[model samples]
Target: SQQGEEDPQALSIQEGENATMNCSYKTSINNLQWYRQNSGRGLVHLILIRSNEREKHSGRLRVTLDTSKKSSSLLITASRAADTASYFCAPRDEKLTFGTGTRLTIIP
Candidate 1:
Protein backbone atom coordinates (compact mmCIF):
# COMPACT_ATOMS: atom_id res chain seq x y z
CA SER A 1 0.00 0.00 0.00
CA GLN A 2 1.71 3.13 -1.19
CA GLN A 3 -1.08 5.51 -0.22
CA GLY A 4 -0.05 8.08 2.38
CA GLU A 5 -1.75 10.85 4.33
CA GLU A 6 -3.88 13.70 3.08
CA ASP A 7 -4.00 17.21 4.49
CA PRO A 8 -6.72 19.46 5.84
CA GLN A 9 -9.01 16.61 6.88
CA ALA A 10 -12.09 18.62 5.89
CA LEU A 11 -13.30 21.62 3.95
CA SER A 12 -16.43 23.71 3.50
CA ILE A 13 -17.40 25.98 0.63
CA GLN A 14 -20.30 27.75 -0.98
CA GLU A 15 -21.93 26.65 -4.19
CA GLY A 16 -20.29 27.97 -7.35
CA GLU A 17 -17.00 28.18 -5.50
CA ASN A 18 -14.00 25.94 -5.96
CA ALA A 19 -12.68 23.31 -3.55
CA THR A 20 -9.10 22.11 -3.36
CA MET A 21 -7.66 19.14 -1.45
CA ASN A 22 -4.11 17.85 -1.21
CA CYS A 23 -2.56 14.43 -0.59
CA SER A 24 0.94 13.27 0.28
CA TYR A 25 2.48 9.83 -0.03
CA LYS A 26 5.70 8.17 1.14
CA THR A 27 6.65 5.67 -1.59
CA SER A 28 7.25 5.53 -5.29
CA ILE A 29 4.14 5.10 -7.36
CA ASN A 30 3.19 4.46 -10.96
CA ASN A 31 0.19 6.70 -10.86
CA LEU A 32 -2.13 8.62 -8.59
CA GLN A 33 -5.93 8.62 -8.62
CA TRP A 34 -8.66 10.62 -6.95
CA TYR A 35 -12.01 9.24 -5.86
CA ARG A 36 -15.22 10.70 -4.49
CA GLN A 37 -17.42 8.99 -1.91
CA ASN A 38 -20.90 10.16 -1.09
CA SER A 39 -21.80 10.00 2.59
CA GLY A 40 -21.64 6.27 3.45
CA ARG A 41 -21.62 4.89 -0.09
CA GLY A 42 -19.06 3.48 -2.45
CA LEU A 43 -16.28 5.49 -4.03
CA VAL A 44 -16.34 6.64 -7.63
CA HIS A 45 -13.17 7.24 -9.62
CA LEU A 46 -12.77 10.87 -10.46
CA ILE A 47 -9.44 11.22 -12.21
CA LEU A 48 -6.03 9.72 -12.57
CA ILE A 49 -2.60 11.24 -13.27
CA ARG A 50 0.41 9.20 -14.09
CA SER A 51 3.91 9.77 -12.78
CA ASN A 52 4.89 11.08 -16.18
CA GLU A 53 1.99 13.48 -16.21
CA ARG A 54 1.91 16.70 -14.27
CA GLU A 55 -1.75 17.63 -14.52
CA LYS A 56 -5.09 16.36 -15.78
CA HIS A 57 -8.63 17.67 -15.89
CA SER A 58 -12.11 16.23 -16.23
CA GLY A 59 -15.30 18.23 -16.47
CA ARG A 60 -14.98 20.65 -13.53
CA LEU A 61 -12.29 18.67 -11.75
CA ARG A 62 -8.56 19.25 -12.02
CA VAL A 63 -5.69 17.15 -10.68
CA THR A 64 -2.01 17.90 -10.25
CA LEU A 65 0.85 15.67 -9.27
CA ASP A 66 4.33 16.49 -8.03
CA THR A 67 6.30 13.30 -7.94
CA SER A 68 9.37 14.97 -6.46
CA LYS A 69 7.34 15.95 -3.43
CA LYS A 70 5.27 12.79 -3.40
CA SER A 71 2.17 14.91 -3.28
CA SER A 72 -0.93 15.58 -5.35
CA SER A 73 -3.89 17.92 -5.36
CA LEU A 74 -7.47 17.88 -6.61
CA LEU A 75 -9.47 20.97 -7.48
CA ILE A 76 -13.17 21.12 -8.14
CA THR A 77 -14.42 24.15 -9.97
CA ALA A 78 -17.82 25.72 -9.64
CA SER A 79 -18.84 23.32 -6.95
CA ARG A 80 -22.44 22.40 -6.28
CA ALA A 81 -24.15 21.20 -3.12
CA ALA A 82 -24.40 17.74 -4.64
CA ASP A 83 -20.61 17.70 -4.91
CA THR A 84 -20.30 17.55 -1.16
CA ALA A 85 -18.50 14.33 -0.32
CA SER A 86 -15.26 12.75 0.82
CA TYR A 87 -12.33 12.83 -1.64
CA PHE A 88 -9.38 10.46 -1.47
CA CYS A 89 -6.07 10.02 -3.25
CA ALA A 90 -4.74 6.60 -4.06
CA PRO A 91 -1.07 6.37 -4.96
CA ARG A 92 -0.58 3.01 -6.52
CA ASP A 93 2.00 0.71 -8.05
CA GLU A 94 -0.19 -2.30 -8.57
CA LYS A 95 -2.99 -2.09 -6.01
CA LEU A 96 -4.85 0.95 -4.79
CA THR A 97 -4.54 2.07 -1.19
CA PHE A 98 -6.67 4.88 0.12
CA GLY A 99 -5.62 7.38 2.74
CA THR A 100 -7.76 9.38 5.08
CA GLY A 101 -9.97 11.52 2.86
CA THR A 102 -10.99 15.16 2.86
CA ARG A 103 -14.63 15.79 3.63
CA LEU A 104 -16.03 18.63 1.58
CA THR A 105 -19.30 20.37 2.32
CA ILE A 106 -20.87 22.62 -0.25
CA ILE A 107 -23.37 25.19 0.99
CA PRO A 108 -26.19 25.77 -1.41
Candidate 2:
Protein backbone atom coordinates (compact mmCIF):
# COMPACT_ATOMS: atom_id res chain seq x y z
CA SER A 1 0.00 0.00 0.00
CA GLN A 2 2.81 2.42 -0.56
CA GLN A 3 1.59 3.28 -4.04
CA GLY A 4 -1.53 3.46 -6.17
CA GLU A 5 -4.22 0.93 -5.33
CA GLU A 6 -4.97 -1.16 -8.40
CA ASP A 7 -8.52 -2.30 -8.79
CA PRO A 8 -9.66 -5.78 -9.72
CA GLN A 9 -6.30 -6.94 -8.37
CA ALA A 10 -6.93 -10.19 -10.19
CA LEU A 11 -7.97 -9.96 -13.82
CA SER A 12 -8.65 -12.51 -16.54
CA ILE A 13 -8.97 -11.85 -20.24
CA GLN A 14 -8.79 -13.70 -23.53
CA GLU A 15 -5.53 -13.81 -25.49
CA GLY A 16 -6.50 -11.10 -27.98
CA GLU A 17 -8.51 -9.06 -25.46
CA ASN A 18 -7.43 -6.02 -23.50
CA ALA A 19 -6.93 -6.02 -19.72
CA THR A 20 -7.75 -2.76 -17.98
CA MET A 21 -6.75 -1.84 -14.44
CA ASN A 22 -7.53 1.33 -12.51
CA CYS A 23 -5.14 3.01 -10.12
CA SER A 24 -6.43 5.87 -8.00
CA TYR A 25 -4.15 8.15 -6.02
CA LYS A 26 -4.71 11.11 -3.68
CA THR A 27 -1.74 13.40 -4.48
CA SER A 28 -0.21 14.23 -7.86
CA ILE A 29 2.85 12.50 -9.27
CA ASN A 30 5.70 13.16 -11.71
CA ASN A 31 5.66 10.05 -13.90
CA LEU A 32 4.35 6.50 -14.14
CA GLN A 33 5.62 3.16 -15.39
CA TRP A 34 3.90 0.04 -16.77
CA TYR A 35 5.48 -3.34 -16.18
CA ARG A 36 5.09 -6.57 -18.15
CA GLN A 37 5.53 -9.96 -16.51
CA ASN A 38 6.14 -13.40 -17.99
CA SER A 39 5.04 -15.58 -15.07
CA GLY A 40 8.71 -15.92 -14.16
CA ARG A 41 10.00 -12.35 -13.84
CA GLY A 42 8.55 -9.75 -11.44
CA LEU A 43 8.20 -6.41 -13.34
CA VAL A 44 9.17 -6.08 -16.95
CA HIS A 45 8.99 -2.47 -18.13
CA LEU A 46 6.35 -1.84 -20.75
CA ILE A 47 6.01 1.94 -20.90
CA LEU A 48 6.74 5.28 -19.21
CA ILE A 49 4.72 8.50 -18.75
CA ARG A 50 5.97 11.76 -17.32
CA SER A 51 4.13 14.33 -15.19
CA ASN A 52 3.94 16.76 -18.09
CA GLU A 53 2.66 13.99 -20.27
CA ARG A 54 -1.02 13.18 -20.41
CA GLU A 55 -0.74 9.74 -21.98
CA LYS A 56 1.56 7.11 -23.46
CA HIS A 57 1.36 4.07 -25.73
CA SER A 58 3.38 0.94 -26.44
CA GLY A 59 2.36 -1.95 -28.65
CA ARG A 60 -0.77 -2.83 -26.59
CA LEU A 61 -0.03 -0.95 -23.36
CA ARG A 62 -1.54 2.42 -22.51
CA VAL A 63 -0.81 4.40 -19.31
CA THR A 64 -2.35 7.57 -17.88
CA LEU A 65 -1.50 8.17 -14.23
CA ASP A 66 -1.58 6.90 -10.61
CA THR A 67 -0.68 7.87 -7.05
CA SER A 68 2.20 6.18 -5.28
CA LYS A 69 3.38 6.76 -1.70
CA LYS A 70 6.71 5.28 -0.56
CA SER A 71 7.41 3.39 -3.79
CA SER A 72 9.63 6.23 -4.99
CA SER A 73 12.46 4.99 -2.82
CA LEU A 74 12.00 1.43 -3.96
CA LEU A 75 11.96 2.46 -7.61
CA ILE A 76 15.05 4.62 -7.28
CA THR A 77 16.94 1.98 -5.34
CA ALA A 78 16.13 -0.76 -7.79
CA SER A 79 17.16 1.35 -10.76
CA ARG A 80 20.55 2.09 -9.22
CA ALA A 81 21.28 -1.26 -7.64
CA ALA A 82 19.93 -4.24 -9.58
CA ASP A 83 20.39 -2.26 -12.81
CA THR A 84 17.43 -4.27 -13.86
CA ALA A 85 16.24 -1.45 -16.11
CA SER A 86 13.05 -1.17 -14.05
CA TYR A 87 10.72 1.75 -14.68
CA PHE A 88 8.60 3.97 -12.32
CA CYS A 89 6.50 7.12 -12.40
CA ALA A 90 3.27 8.83 -11.28
CA PRO A 91 0.40 8.42 -13.71
CA ARG A 92 -1.82 11.40 -14.47
CA ASP A 93 -4.96 9.40 -15.07
CA GLU A 94 -6.38 6.36 -13.26
CA LYS A 95 -6.76 3.63 -15.84
CA LEU A 96 -4.31 1.16 -17.41
CA THR A 97 -5.05 -1.23 -20.24
CA PHE A 98 -2.45 -3.81 -21.14
CA GLY A 99 -2.44 -5.74 -24.35
CA THR A 100 -1.75 -9.37 -23.44
CA GLY A 101 0.12 -10.17 -26.65
CA THR A 102 2.64 -7.34 -26.61
CA ARG A 103 6.32 -7.69 -25.73
CA LEU A 104 8.91 -5.09 -24.61
CA THR A 105 12.57 -5.11 -23.61
CA ILE A 106 14.37 -2.35 -21.68
CA ILE A 107 18.11 -1.99 -21.05
CA PRO A 108 19.81 0.55 -18.79
Candidate 3:
Protein backbone atom coordinates (compact mmCIF):
# COMPACT_ATOMS: atom_id res chain seq x y z
CA SER A 1 0.00 0.00 0.00
CA GLN A 2 1.25 3.45 -0.87
CA GLN A 3 -0.56 4.71 2.18
CA GLY A 4 0.69 7.58 4.34
CA GLU A 5 0.79 7.92 8.12
CA GLU A 6 -0.88 10.65 10.13
CA ASP A 7 0.73 11.85 13.32
CA PRO A 8 -0.82 12.55 16.71
CA GLN A 9 -3.28 9.70 16.29
CA ALA A 10 -5.76 11.78 18.25
CA LEU A 11 -6.33 15.44 19.00
CA SER A 12 -8.68 17.51 21.16
CA ILE A 13 -9.40 21.16 20.53
CA GLN A 14 -11.91 23.67 21.75
CA GLU A 15 -14.49 25.21 19.46
CA GLY A 16 -13.22 28.16 17.40
CA GLU A 17 -9.65 26.85 17.61
CA ASN A 18 -7.60 25.66 14.70
CA ALA A 19 -6.79 21.98 14.03
CA THR A 20 -3.85 20.66 12.11
CA MET A 21 -2.75 17.19 11.03
CA ASN A 22 0.23 15.85 9.16
CA CYS A 23 0.62 12.85 6.83
CA SER A 24 3.80 11.24 5.61
CA TYR A 25 4.00 8.76 2.76
CA LYS A 26 6.64 6.33 1.56
CA THR A 27 6.77 6.83 -2.24
CA SER A 28 6.14 9.19 -5.07
CA ILE A 29 2.48 9.91 -5.84
CA ASN A 30 0.47 11.46 -8.62
CA ASN A 31 -1.75 13.32 -6.22
CA LEU A 32 -2.87 13.44 -2.59
CA GLN A 33 -6.38 13.87 -1.26
CA TRP A 34 -7.86 14.64 2.12
CA TYR A 35 -11.17 13.36 3.43
CA ARG A 36 -13.27 13.62 6.54
CA GLN A 37 -15.32 10.88 8.19
CA ASN A 38 -17.98 11.50 10.75
CA SER A 39 -18.90 8.58 13.00
CA GLY A 40 -20.42 5.85 10.76
CA ARG A 41 -21.18 8.02 7.77
CA GLY A 42 -19.29 7.96 4.50
CA LEU A 43 -16.12 9.95 4.06
CA VAL A 44 -16.33 13.32 2.31
CA HIS A 45 -13.65 14.74 0.03
CA LEU A 46 -12.18 17.89 1.46
CA ILE A 47 -9.45 18.70 -1.05
CA LEU A 48 -7.13 17.29 -3.68
CA ILE A 49 -3.80 18.90 -4.49
CA ARG A 50 -1.65 17.50 -7.26
CA SER A 51 2.04 16.67 -6.80
CA ASN A 52 3.13 19.80 -8.63
CA GLU A 53 1.06 22.00 -6.39
CA ARG A 54 2.36 23.41 -3.15
CA GLU A 55 -0.79 24.60 -1.36
CA LYS A 56 -4.54 24.97 -1.78
CA HIS A 57 -7.42 26.31 0.23
CA SER A 58 -11.14 25.66 0.58
CA GLY A 59 -13.23 27.86 2.80
CA ARG A 60 -11.87 27.21 6.30
CA LEU A 61 -9.42 24.53 5.27
CA ARG A 62 -5.85 24.97 4.04
CA VAL A 63 -3.56 22.22 2.77
CA THR A 64 0.13 22.09 1.99
CA LEU A 65 2.02 19.48 0.06
CA ASP A 66 5.76 18.82 0.13
CA THR A 67 6.86 16.38 -2.55
CA SER A 68 10.52 16.54 -1.55
CA LYS A 69 9.75 15.23 1.92
CA LYS A 70 6.82 13.11 0.68
CA SER A 71 4.45 14.64 3.18
CA SER A 72 1.31 16.74 3.43
CA SER A 73 -0.52 18.72 6.07
CA LEU A 74 -4.11 19.81 6.59
CA LEU A 75 -5.10 22.86 8.58
CA ILE A 76 -8.62 23.68 9.64
CA THR A 77 -9.11 27.19 10.95
CA ALA A 78 -11.94 28.61 13.02
CA SER A 79 -13.08 25.13 13.83
CA ARG A 80 -16.47 24.50 15.33
CA ALA A 81 -17.71 21.63 17.48
CA ALA A 82 -19.59 20.44 14.42
CA ASP A 83 -16.26 19.99 12.67
CA THR A 84 -15.28 17.10 14.92
CA ALA A 85 -14.38 14.10 12.82
CA SER A 86 -11.63 11.75 11.70
CA TYR A 87 -9.39 12.97 8.88
CA PHE A 88 -7.47 10.77 6.47
CA CYS A 89 -5.16 11.26 3.51
CA ALA A 90 -5.35 8.93 0.53
CA PRO A 91 -3.18 8.66 -2.51
CA ARG A 92 -4.87 9.28 -5.85
CA ASP A 93 -6.08 6.07 -7.46
CA GLU A 94 -9.18 4.07 -8.35
CA LYS A 95 -9.17 2.52 -4.88
CA LEU A 96 -7.50 4.78 -2.37
CA THR A 97 -4.87 3.58 0.05
CA PHE A 98 -5.74 5.65 3.11
CA GLY A 99 -3.67 6.52 6.14
CA THR A 100 -4.42 5.47 9.72
CA GLY A 101 -6.19 8.80 10.15
CA THR A 102 -6.27 11.53 12.77
CA ARG A 103 -9.15 11.33 15.23
CA LEU A 104 -10.05 14.95 15.94
CA THR A 105 -12.42 16.13 18.63
CA ILE A 106 -13.71 19.69 18.89
CA ILE A 107 -14.87 20.50 22.38
CA PRO A 108 -17.96 22.63 22.72
Per-residue alpha-carbon lDDT of candidate 2 for residues 14-42, written as tens digits (9 for 90 to 100): 33334455544455655655554554566
* TM-scores of the models, in the order given: 0.96, 0.53, 0.95
- lDDT per residue, candidate 1, 1-108, as tens digits? 677577779999999999999999988999998999998899999998999999999999999999999999999999999999999999988887888899999999
Clashing pairs in 2: 31-89, 31-90, 32-89, 32-90, 65-91, 65-92, 65-93, 66-91
**True lDDT of residue 11, candidate 2:** 42
Q: After superposition, how far is residue 69 of candidate 2 from its true place, in Å?
A: 16
Give every collision pair in model 1: none
Q: lDDT by residue for model 3 over 1-108, one digit each (tens)?
A: 588799879999999999999999887888999999999999999999999999999999999999999999999999998899999998764468887899999999
Off by over 4 Å in 3: 93-95
**Candidates ranked by TM-score:** 1, 3, 2
Ranking by lDDT: 3, 1, 2
How does each model score on lDDT? 0.91, 0.42, 0.92
- Please tell me which model should have the higher lDDT, number 2 or number 3: 3
TM-score of 2: 0.53
Name the lDDT value of residue 53 in candidate 2.
61
